[model samples]
Target chain A: MALSPDDVARLARLARIDLSQAELEHLAPQLDVILESVAEVSKVAADDVKPTSHAIEIANVFREDEVRPSFTAQQALSGAPVKESGRFRVPQILQEDE
Target chain B: MSGLVLQTAADLAGLIAAGEVSAHEVVAAHFERIAQVEPQVQAFLALDEERALAAADRVDAKLAAGEKLGPLAGVPLGLKDIFTYQGLPCTVGSRILEGWHPPYDATVVKRLLDADLIIVGKVNMDEFAMGSSTESSAYKVTHNPWNLDYIPGGSSGGSAAALAAFEVALSVGTDTGGSIRQPAAVNSLVGVKPTYGSNSRFGVVAMASSLDVPGPFGRTVLDAALLHEAISGYDPMDSTSLNLPIPPVAQAARSGEIKGYRIGVVKELGGEGYAPGVLQRFNESLALLESAGAEIAEISCPHFTYALGAYYLIMPSEVSSNLARFDAMRYGIRVGDDGKRSAEEVMNLTRGAGFGAEVKRRVIIGTYALSAGYYDAYYGSALKVRTLIQQDFDAAFAKVDVLVSPTSPTTAWKIGERLDDPLAMYKADLCTIPANLAGICAASIPVGLSSENGLPVGFQIMAPAMADDRLYRVGAALERGVADAFGGPVLNQLIGSPAWDALSAQAVAARFPNIILGLAENLS
Candidate 1:
């Protein structure tokens, strides 16, 4: 239940947020208390009870696949911080992860 | 004209429908009231005056043409910032989404438009609906109209405050964990969180998906119910929306009677930890319900004690997954791009820079909860707890028709009182969280005023899932009983008054040496 500083750091990395040392220090105890409090749920709830993700019982309700018109390439690129030859430019990855 | 601002949506609609008042006049009056009180309350993020008037004119044009308008025609309402409207910027109250306007209208918004309601504006909220108080709104803090120094409750605080300030007759708000009810409790408005799938969530900015419910806040229970009737139904767009008949909420509210009703007050709520004034009001309200031919008893849901813990875990887990979509590329608000870096790296940088502190905190917690080694320990276990809580409600509902409790553990606290401590803020929803966890419909109605600080107090009426009509029926009867017993609703009396007179007097004495008299207007 106790979250160590390393645990906090790992969580930050997983969440992709950069945290300052002071923030990490502050968050460690806060998260510890929160986790400790929530730990009680495990005590009351049994292993046999099925976990619920949605409050209501529902299943897939997908829309029919169809071609939909999109904004102009210029309009799409208008808000991008940077653009290149009508495409979005970004940092290189895997040298080509996608 | 002044009383028109205080009229319920039902009354306003009747007047508008009967040709006694033009829709345009009603809209204009509300616009005037907004101009008067909006400066003090900070309820709205966006108000399209021209659009509202044009819509009102159209409603009038229909009436003039002898066409039957809808029940809510010309009734001005506020939309929480989360619901996406075609041209309106849906910021979700975060700087990261400064001017992001979706190309589509949320299903609920479309439904409301079909219902002939005029949207006066978008209300402010806690950024991404993360915070318990509206202070987390990127725009500004929404002040409680009763006491400007106090919080109006959040993340639907702006909608509640708008209702409290008489700016809007009814407003739509999304409740994840008591967001709608808590704010309603603080501002003494009628707010209901329906069974999770009662309303469509297509355009709502995701908070904790499972718990997020779009509901109505109004000055009267009937108004709230009427609004609910307007918006509830199956939506094919949202897979989670229940394929069920929309209950007749408006009819239930009209015929709301508590004779022979079995109402059980939760043993966990209204205990030692509650402020004395809040407990007193709750007790008095319970007594009123009992006197009104209702049978009241104490019911214990042992597993209910762990609801907050389970909620925190479950909410963050979902939020972590839900917010992951805001990676700057697919939608609005992108941050830095080192240009040479990959799309994933740019997304990371954008989210890192765009999100506020509390949002980042939740995302981190959510990520931790859903992480590899911890998933079973946190999210899975928390979900198990949620199931147990649902069973608890199931068992309790078998013994009684519905549950009753103080809507919140405490009345509205001062703005800065619990902001420094997020846990303390989370604890404020203790009394209201059980219903959300159980996925039942819950309503909060003004019971009385907390004499300690003279702020509004609220009582919660909860019903089993899909029994949303019962919540309004019981709530309306309880509201009438409490108001009758108290001579008037507490919120009507507290508007524009200092919530904590002693605190105000002390500050005035310290700051103004010569001032010995209490100045209500000057205090705010």
Candidate 2:
């Protein structure tokens, strides 16, 4: 249950949040304690019991296939930190090719 | 006559409807109060004075036109920042979304407007509703109205503090675990977390999709019920929204009868680790309920002990997924987007800078839990424990009409008491988490003050899902019984407290120095 700094770093990377070396070190022990404490869940979770994702049962809802009034492009882009031509502008994903 | 700002939501509604008070006057009174006390309480993150007055004017105009007003017409409400209000900043208490004005109103916000409740302002919260205390708010700390040094329990602390401080009679709050109820408990107000999915989460800033529920906070049970009725119902926008009629909670509150009702005390929630005064008040409330003809029994919810463990895992797992949408591109603060860095790198940098330490800790924990190899042992096991907790509720509810416990283990602690210890902070929600895990409705009403610290303690009443009315009935009955014993509401005791007087004087001096010599003088 001991979470290593490497594990903390990996988790931060997977979660898409950058962490400093100090944060990783500080969080590793705390996370290890939390994980060990929460690991109690495994002790009582019998195999026969079904895992519940939602508290109540919900089926996929369907609406008629028709156009509806929704957020306009302007509204959608209103809160975007970076926008270009009414679309979210993210940094380049592809590398330059020869 | 009581000042308009100090009047309960029900009384304000009545005054407005009877033409004894104008909505404009009520809104203005609250703004004055906010101006006087907000410096110390730090309850609000944003206040739209112009919009609030404009909204109030429309209510008055409607009344003048002889139009029927809703139950909460003309009442000002403090909206927790987690919900989107069109053209209003919805930070959800994070630096990432700071100053970001949402383009649309949340379903609940629209509903509140339709009910004619004026939005006073957006209140503060724990960052993304992640913490038990409001200390995690990136903006500012919200001090308890009773004692400036103690926390106004959170992550709905600001909403509860606003009510306790007489800044607003009603407010909206969200409870992922016990955000609304815990804050309500410590502040001696009524907080209700309705049945999961009973209220739409369409425009709410999602923390844990399954656990997050927007609820109401009021100075009285009836007030909370009235606000709950106004803001809750089915909505197509939220897939998980329950397709059912809104329960008659307000009616139940008015009736306030618990005759022939079987109320069970969950043996697991009390004793050991609970403050003596909290247990004392809880026992007193139970005795009162029994005197009012409620059949009390001891019920053992064996699996509830694992509830906190399961909730931390499941909540963070959902949080990690839900917050993944907060990448630098789509919204809020963006860092290092000079076009040279990759999107992923920018996203990482932005999130690291944007999220607070607690939020980051949860994301890391959740990432680890839902990671490839550990998924089954962590998230999967937690979900199964959730099932076990639900089964516990099912069995208990089968034997009783409602379950009762102290809302929180202790009264409001000092602000920095548990900030360094996350585990200690997490334990604050132990008694309230079962209801959320079971998707049932639960309410916290002021029972009495804790003898240990002289702060407020709350008695919790929980009912089965969709049977939300039962919670109101039990809460209203207990509220009546306690109020009768105290000769008034429990929070009325704070009126003469030296802490309140000192805090009020400080707040008044800090901001409204031109006004009365002492703001607490006017308050009393």
* lDDT for each residue of candidate 2 in B250-314, tens digit (9 for 90 to 100): 99999988889999999999999999999999999999999999999999999999999999899
Docking class of 2: high
Highest TM-score: give the candidate number.
2
Task: Please list the residue runs of candidate 2 whose C-alpha ends up more than 4 Å from where it truly belongs after superposition.
Answer: B507-524
> Model 1, which residues run further than 4 Å from truth?
A60-89, A94-98, B1-3, B495-524
Tell me which residue pairs clash in candidate 2.
none
Clashing pairs in 1: A91-B340, A91-B341, A91-B342, A92-B340, A92-B341, A92-B342
TM-score of candidate 2 versus the correct structure, residues matched by position? 0.96
